[model samples]
Structure formats: C-alpha cells, structure tokens
Target: MKIKRSAATIIGEVSALILTFLTHWVVFYFIIINSFKTRAEAARLSLAFPKKWQIIENYSYILSYGDGLFFRSMWNSIRLTIISIVILVLVASMTGYIMQRRQGKFSKISNKLILAGLIVPPSVISTYWILSQLGVVGTLAGLTLVEVATMFPFSVMIYKGYMATIPRDIDAAAIIDGCSASRLYFQIIFPILKPITATIVILRSVVVYNDFANPLYYMSGARNSTIQLFVYTFQSAFLTQWNYLFAAIVLISLPPFILYLILNKRILEGVTAGAVKG
Candidate 1:
C-alpha cells in the first residue's frame, strides 16, 4: 500500500530546507563578500560586491603580516592536530576494545567514569596547575596532552560501541590460531574497525583542528600560536583592518573545508555504519 504524504509535512520539509540554505548562504556570503572588499567597504559589512576589489592586496598583506605569523600558526595547528589524532586513535582504540571485551566490575566502573567525562567540563585552573607542575605549562607538548585527554572519552565510546557488534568467535578463533592478544587486535580486529575509525578520525580531526577554547586556555603563554589563536591576535592588532581579517579567515578555513569535501562520502558511510552496528 502506498502512503500519501500530508500537506503539512511537505510544507514543513520545504521550510526546513529553505532555512538551512539561507543560514549557510548568509555565512558564506559575508565571508566571501567582505574578503574582497576594502577596509572601509568591509567595515560596513555590506552584502554587496566591493567598489574597489583588493583581493590580492588583502591576501598578500595577511600572508606577510608580522613576518608571516599566519603561516607559523598554521604549522603549529597542523602539528598539534597530527599529534593529538595519532595518540587519540591508538589509545582510544585499545581502551575501547579492552573495555568492550573484558567483562568485570573494573570495566563497569571505567565505563561510568568515561560517561562522566562526557558530561563534565574540565577545570582550567586545575589543568593549568598540573601542567605547571610538569614544567610543560606553556609548551605545545602540554597543549597536545590536554587535547588528547579531552578527546579521549568520546573517541573511546565510539570505538567501544562499535566493538560490541563484533562476534566473540573471531577472538576465540584468532587465539586458537596462536595469535597473541596484541597481534589479534592489531592485525585482525583493527581491520574490521575501519569504518568506525574513519568516522572518529574525520569528526575528531575537525573538532581538534577548529578548537578555540582549549588552546586559548592552555596555550596563552606559548610563543607560537595555533591558527585560531593567530586569528584572535590578528583581530586585536588589526582592529580596524576588516579586509585583512576576512582574508585571513578565508585562508585559514580552506584546509579543513578541503579535507571535508574530499572525505565527506567516507565520513557519512562510517557514521551511518557505526550508528547501525552500535
């Protein structure tokens, strides 16, 4: 039997789509339009095209500003992201696999703690104090640790939920075939986890890359800054230079945007597969 769609449902769907389009259009329009305008024109924050386009000048100035500080910040962001993701993937995968496979009081308690981490916010002052005691308070390494720790709980939950779907027969079979626990997980089980892993990688990478609050709190004293920090500093220094600021925003946004475009299909597949399996 064919079910007919109601008029209200159709209207609601259309309204939702229009709202979504307008939201994205307004944001991109502001960024792209202002990016091409002169400082005075951009200051107006107008939706119109620039009377005198200064694309080249604006971009050039941003790139060369403060001895190429933008590029430095970009590199810092890349480094921090890479380190954080690598550690997160390795640690979370292992922890999740263990938590899912091992049935005991310990696992139950650990699960509760991990869930609590999701609900609770970290104390910035306490974290700062710990880092200071470790003598890495103002260093990139310290910030990397903070990022990995912050992201670990969510990543582990994703992996653990996905691991629940895998049959215990696989583990028993691998063990009977003389595979050690480490070898079994790394060689056999990890391969099966590719879909969920891809989801974690894409989602967590975006979060860590675009993170502003963690870096702001933990890395304020660092000599080199992350891309977001650089933007904040640039805004303060060039308070009236809206054109340059917008240009910088566009450039900084390109890397993650390009990454998402390239891997969007995989991201969707991974997320859906994880959700269904979990």
Candidate 2:
C-alpha cells in the first residue's frame, strides 16, 4: 500500500525547510559578504553586497600576516586533532568492547563512572592543576590528553551501544580458532566496528578541530596556538578589523567543510547503521 501526504502537510514541511535554509544562509551570507568588503564596510556589518570588493586583498593579507601565524596555527590544530582522534578511537573502542563483553561488578562501576563523565562538566581548575603536577600544562601533549579524556565518554557510549548488537558466537568462534585476546579484537572485532568507528571519527573530528574553549583555557600559556585561537589575534582594544577576521574565518572553515563534503556519504551511512543497530 502507498500512503500520500496531504497538501497541507506538504506545504508545512516545505515552509519549515525554507525557513531553516534562510536562517542558516543569512549567517553564511553575512560572513561571506563581509569577507569581501573593505575593513570600514565590514565594520558596519551590513547585509548588502560590498561597495568595494577586497576579497583578494583581504585573503592575501590574512595569509601573510604575523609571519604566517595563521598557517602555523592551522598546522597545530591538525596535529592535535590527528593525535587526539587516534588515541580516542583506540582507547574508547577497546574500553567499550571490554565493558560490553565482560559482565561484572567492575564493569557496572565503570559504566556508572562513564555515565557520570557524560553528565558532569570538567573542572578546569582541577584539570589544570593535574596537568601542572604532571609538568605538561603548557604543552601540546597535555592538550591532546584533555581532548581525548573529554571526548572519551561519548565515544565509548556510541561504541558500546553498537557492540551490543554483535553476537557472542563471533567471539566464541574467534577464541576457538586459537586467537589471542589482542588478536581477536584487533584482527576480527575491530574490523567489524567500522560503521560506528566512522561515525565517531567524523563527529569527534569536527568537535576537536573546531574546539575553542578548551584551547583557550588549557593552552593559553602555550606559545603555539590552534586555528581557533589564531583567529582571535585579529581583535584589539583599539580597533577590530572585521574584514581580516572574516577572511581568516572563511579560510579556516575550509578544511572541515572539505572533509565533510568528501566523506559525507560514509558519515551518513555510519550514523544510520549505528542508529539502526544500536
């Protein structure tokens, strides 16, 4: 049997979609238009097209400014994101597998703790103090740890939920094949975890790459800055240059946008699979 939507329902859905598109496009329009304007024109923050287009000049200046600090910051963000994602994926996947396969008091306690991690906000002061004690407060390594720790709980939950849909017979068969625990997971189970892993990688990469607050709070003392922090350099007490800022914003936004465009199909598939299975 085929069910058709009424005219009223179709109109409502269309109206909602148009409203959503306009809402997002308005903000994107402001950023793009201002990016092409002169500093004075951008400062006005008008929605009109630029009176004097300075797109090339603005982009060139932004790229060349501060001895190429923008690119350096981009590199820093890339390094952080890469390291953090690798560590998060490995540790979270393994932990989730263990928590799901092993049923015990310890697992129960761990589940509660993981749930607490999701509910509770991180304590900046305590985290900084711990990093200070470890003598890594101002280093990239420490910031990477922070990102992994903060994102771990959510990733674990996602993996654990997906893992529940897997049968124990697979594990039994792997063990019967004389596979070591490590080999069983690494060779067999991990490969099967591709769908959920893809979802985690895509979603968490965006968060870690674009993170602003954590870098500001934890990495403020560091000499190197992430892309988000680098963009803040455009602001000053005397005057704020909106054109240069918008130009930098556009440039910095490209990497993640391109990444999404390339992997959008995989990302959507992974998410849908996780949703259905989990």
Candidate 3:
C-alpha cells in the first residue's frame, strides 16, 4: 500500500510539473517568436515561425523609438524601483522588528492597521487627490512613496514572521551589553535579518519594476513613464504595432525574468525560512 501511494504521489507531481512547464512555455514561445517577426506577420498572432526574421529592425526600432524614450523609461523604472525598495526595506524592517519586540496598545493598534492595509483596496481617486494637494502627483517621488506604501504591509508581515523565529535571548544579551535601542536594532538585529531582507528586496524589486497600474495612476506623460508604460507607444485606438509591442514586452520582461531565474532558490529559501527553521 505504501509503495503504491508513493508511486501515485510521484505521478501526480510529474504531471503537475509538465502541465505548468507547457503552459508557461507556450506563452513564452508565442511572445518570443512574434517579437522576431515583421509587423504584418506579428499581427496575425499565429503559432507559425516567421518567414523572415526582423530581429535587428524590431529591437532597434524599439530602442530608438521616440528619441530613445524606451531608454528613458527604463532609467525611470530602475530609479523608482531602487528608491522604493530602499525606503521599504528600511522602514518596513524597522517597523516589523518593533512590532514583534514591543508589547503595548500602540503596537496592537499598529498591527491591526497593517492588517487593514493588506485587506483594504486602495482608492486611486483619493490617492490622486492627496498627491495633488501635495503637488507630487506626477513626479517620481510621489510614485516612490506610493509604491512603498502599497508594499509595506506584506514586507512587515514577512519580517514579523521571520523575526519571531529569532530568540529573545539575543535582545536580552544586547541590552545587557550597554546597547542603545537604535544600536540594538540597526547594528545587531538588522544584520541578522539578511535572509528576510534579501527576500523582501528581490521580491519587491520585481513587483515595483513591473508595476503598471500604480505608475499609470500616479505618474503620467512620456517623460515620466516607466518601462511598462513605454509599451503604449506601439499601441493605439486605431492601430496597434504588434511586433513592436511584443519586442517592447520582451525588453521590459527580461530584468524580472533573469532576476527570478538567478534567485529563485533564494526566494524560496527566504520565504520558507521562518516556517522551517523555527
């Protein structure tokens, strides 16, 4: 009975893996093959291979489009992503640590608010009004703040979970050694949080980089557009340049795809560390 059950489990796992691979590969293949095709060929959106590859033309045009708007958008995306992640990591990690260590009414209320942040749907109109009042509605700084706010709750939760696994004896020892509160957290605790920090950074970098809606709502115009918005140049109400669009998508997707491939194991390890290690 045990042997049969083991065989059944193995078969189920293999089947799920094959299905996932095929599903993802088909989408990947379609986008890539279309990216190399001519505008007319790509418009058809068929599964067939391109008769004449326009690799250089398609990719080059996308790069040089609108006096290098693509490059500008790419830079904007990188900048926004970096700024947001740094702020989020600093603020969220500290907040998580405090919430875990301290016990009081304020901490309890803060915890509830964090949970509310995760559950509540954000209001674009209200956010716009607030940003408009502050005159940061269309700037990178405004968008950076928005991204940080949006990602805060999840990061805090992750940190809090992982922080629980760390023994309180460490805190007691550090306090006994004449460490100030700030020093204890920043010097002792923060360094120890490398695993969770890495998890938050890698995971949130991908999210902020690939974000479409937040950028669309908070920031506007060609000058301030992110990579996701850069794709809009190839699309229109009357007509869509399918090949150029696909090429732009390929370029936008590469960073996150490469990141996931390189750190996939680390991401898994970080996420599971709290649960498994403790």
The TM-score, computed over Cα atoms with residue i paired to residue i, of candidate 2 is: 0.94
Residue-level lDDT of model 3, residues 1-278, one tens digit each, is 35456888999999999998889988899999999999899999988999999999999999999998999999999999989999999999999888988889988899899999999999999999989998898999999989999999999989988889889999999999999999999898999888788789898999999899999988888999899889977789999999999999999998888877776767776788878432
Model 2 Cα lDDT, one tens digit per residue, 1-278: 98999999999999999998889888888899999999999999999998899989999998988888888899999999999999999999999999999999999999999999999999999999999999988789999999999999999988888888889999999999899999999999999888778778889999999999889988863356899998888888988999999999999989888877877777766666656554
RMSD of each: 1.9, 1.7, 2.2
Model 2 Cα displacement at 249 (Å)?
0.9
lDDT of 1 by residue, 43-108 (tens): 998889889999999999889877878888899999998899989999999999999999999999
Q: Which regions of candidate 1 are displaced past 4 Å?
A: 1-4, 220-222
Clashing pairs in 1: none
lDDT of each: 0.87, 0.90, 0.91
Per-candidate TM vs. native? 0.94, 0.94, 0.93
- The number of the candidate with the highest TM-score is 2
Q: Output the lDDT of residue 207, model 3.
A: 93
Question: What is the Å distance of residue 205 in model 1 from its true position?
Answer: 1.3
Candidate 1 lDDT for residue 167: 92
Better of 1 and 2 by lDDT: 2
